[model samples]
Target: MINKLYFTSLDEQVQQKAFRAIEEEQRSIGYYTLPDQDITPILSYCDSIPDMIETIAVIGIGGSSLGAKAIYEFVKPLNNLSRKLYFFESTDPINITTLLSKIDLEKTHFLVISKSGNTVETFSIYKYIYSLQNDPSAYTFITDPDSPLEKYANEINASVLHLPDNVGGRFSVLSTVGLVPLALCDIDIQALLNGAQTIKQSFFNDGYLKDTLLKKAVFYAKNHAQFHINCIFAYSETLKYFCEWYVQLWGESLGKHQRNSAFHVGLTPIGLIGPKDQHSFLQLIMEGTRDKSVTFIKIEDFHDNITISDITLPHLETLDILNGLPFSKLINMQCDSVMEALEVQGDIPLDSITIPTVNEHSIGSLIYYYELLTSLVGELIDVNTYDQPGVEAGKIILKKKLRVLKK
Candidate 1:
């Protein structure tokens, strides 16, 4: 499988900075340590034979749910899926009402994921679903060991999977948190892990400093001053969720105050779909301010290759250029057309990533790519990438506001 990645504007200095970050990541314990781990536990637990689950609903938000959701979106239509996958990510009442109306509590299994057991959103949604479950035995928990969530799962006799305490929620996708949900959906966990392993192994190679992840980390760090925002557009429908997943991954990891300085280091990531955005957001991105960099992601191959038959109508002779146009080709042409237009008129810098096909392996490789790349970007920017102290500050605010409601 050829994964064609085009990253722009990287020099030797950029490569050097990213290489140092990769070195630091190599020495780490939790996230960078995933490639060496096994996937058997999550896979075996989610197997179809004994459980025979018909649906899996993941209840969580941000990193807790996005990674699994991204992987699911990419691989779902590609596979002859036996089980359905759904998500309850928001405390928004309309979301809760609409999702609850659709699920059949009997055959639907639930995955309640939280890195920390205390997220109000996760538990609130869980409480709602748990109240409705006639067979709560199908519920499972993915969280840190000995966390409140794990303890609660134990009290309910629900199956509990522990995440490494040091692995942040954003980086927990390759771990049990994401794999369990994916395994439940009949995805190939082994191949996915193998793909991740490929990238991990690449880091130890002869030209490790010249790797794609390093190049990307360098690109962001070097350009962070002017291009404060990273605009990601996914051309494929299957990749729409990947864009959302990257938002959390890039924003939370990089958005941090500099060490003992008045300044903060951050990259604001905004996700958009391809041609749709070409109509809506492109107008602004092309002619608007020059403070953003754009990344375009396109899947190289599609399953359906039906060509459009030539159309002949009374006044449509001008449209004959569209004869024998495969819908796939048309989609690709639209992507290229937008890219050309941007290149011609826009000042936004660009990166293009082309995956050979949308499958477990390619998707896994992508997860690893961003995880490692984000870590490297953190290093280049000279900040602690792992911790989310700002996020905690928000939670503290939430606690006080929530307490007032009870009083």
Candidate 2:
């Protein structure tokens, strides 16, 4: 596998729970199977895009935008893409105004994605954009087949990409949600899916699960209560948005209430960029309360050979040791040093995952790895991993608040 997982191991029982999760998920419309989907529709739609379209403004939030954003950010540099992909996900007027100022509506293609198709902030943003360009061809709606957004798209003769009703927004990345934007940007989405398939197939195989996925899921399940926070220290800046997507996926999928019990359960997820945050959040993880489970992610080969200059100033003579060293080496060294320090400090549950490179394949493998881990941990905790009742309740409340404001 291009993505390698390293961690401390656990007992058979926990591993068995992970296996159970895999079995259960196999029967449902779980995201793990998404890699096996035929993406002809996504590709065909991308092929039909007019050559004059220079920008793709994705209108979505949370699961809707994060996965696609993660994909674009992680591997855009690897491919020579000419079209710009922007996100219009906020209700903040300044955010909308700033995004609007960047692109010409005439040359921009909009992808309005909302799983429920009734997302308040999503449609609110879309409504404003609609005012500027009501041309159906200028927009594509990615939503559930019969959703209000889909109905509206059909009425306007706008193009439509359907999300499987069972697939949640966070898990819908391998679906049309992420693939459409990625394919439009000239990304080899099939390669991304193939990478995910490699992991998924290996995971389902008898031998591969024991060492990697099982070890990870079991660690979180066994230590969920004691280690209340799960933090990811991703070393590469390219992984910044990937960490954000992980936060949403891990936080929302696992956090839940059990109807039979009085206590609410979930691990709070924190995302930090390493070397940068090593100066900040790493201190808290090192000496603060022993309530966190940390995962350190490093890219083995950044594929860039930029190096520090051999010249050193009189006052900065101490930094001369790093002169001529590749920045990639320095960053990897920082990641390794941090992992070693964490190991020495002890008590905190820590693991490391190394990716050979930040290509579509490795990014795809990493995405499925986290998604599978979330499912496994949820199984062990006995929570409904696929649903977000708490979030739904909040959405209901927001609608009422908006109605009151309108009155």
Candidate 3:
């Protein structure tokens, strides 16, 4: 039922090929049932957690933390709950020490998310927390079955949830990786999964050219040839991590070497909380010399409603033209109008992604949509979307530096 848009540039043959590849790849992953097994337990556990969970901290890096952060921000305004949520994914001692000092570890519930159960940053943080804990039962592990973290959780009588082996971290949000933290934050995980299902059905029923994910793939591929930099600017503060998650998903998946040619992909993310950035980054974005594309995300509503007021200026007391519109709507309209003008003058291509509301379902749909789009782009560029050899290389180098420093 959604009106699908295809790129104007891609040829029919290329489009068809890309679609087939995406379909095969998505099917191989078993998209629909992958998250089902983990979802129920995560939801039930989240529901069962007592009101004693006043403050929550999630410990993990990259995909583990990014997905939950995105969901927390997106759904926080709607729930109006007061529980404070913090995420710790860095190895920097100062950040970790500061984070621990701010929260009472005994009272706070910690969710340790790592699919492999051996991520150095996650393991390091877990070890640090383990050392500080008078009671290890305060922590939970979301990891692969039979993994070290799962065993450790059992040994300590802590809760454990298994992650699907085939599901990559960037795509694991619908599962325990994303669901548990979201549920704890008072977000509706079912609605988010429902949104994902809706998009999945759309991708399945529609033809290649009519597929939204495929269209997104072709659009990026076409533009990527000219403008190598892709930037995602989310207008809402809550959606900031959504852009961060996307940067990782797109960058890691598409940056690789293929049998035909080398694939080069890069993503730069910027978060803007509305008229705030108008004074800061707008001038540079409007005139700066950069080969990049911008995707602007707007949420239709916010927790704080706007009110209309009449204030007559001394010189404009007789003028009655500025008294009609709601401030929120006015701002939204002004932003759209300005963006349209910028597009016309600068030839800067823009994509607008508007959600009817910010909830679990909308978040699910958006995340899943991006995952599919990233996969399609990877396929088009002949890159391996599931592997990240480059990321591990950095870790290897870092370990050698740490050994030398310890001396």
The backbone clash count of each candidate, in order, is 0, 0, 3
lDDT of 2 by residue, 63-176 (tens): 999999999999987678879999998999999999999999999999999888889889899999999998889999999888898899999898998886478888988889
Write the residue-wise lDDT of candidate 1 on 3-98 in tens digits. 334446548776765676567666664888787777766666766324656788899888888988999999988689878889999999999999
- Report residue 285 deviation for candidate 2 (angstroms): 0.6
Cα deviation at 150, candidate 2, in Å, is 1.4
| Candidate 3 per-residue lDDT over residues 44-103, each given as its tens digit | 787767777777889999988898888887788768754678888998999999998889
Q: Pick the candidate with the highest TM-score.
A: 2
- Candidate number achieving the greatest lDDT relative to the actual structure: 2
lDDT of model 1, residue 211 = 60
RMSD of each: 2.3, 1.6, 3.1
Residue runs of model 2 more than 4 Å from their true location after superposition: 1-9, 207-210
Judge candidate 3 at residue 233 and give its lDDT. Answer: 54
Tell me how far the alpha carbon of residue 228 in candidate 2 is from the true structure, in angstroms, after superposition: 1.3
The window of 10 residues in a row where model 3 has the poorest summed lDDT is: 1-10
Clashes of 1: 0
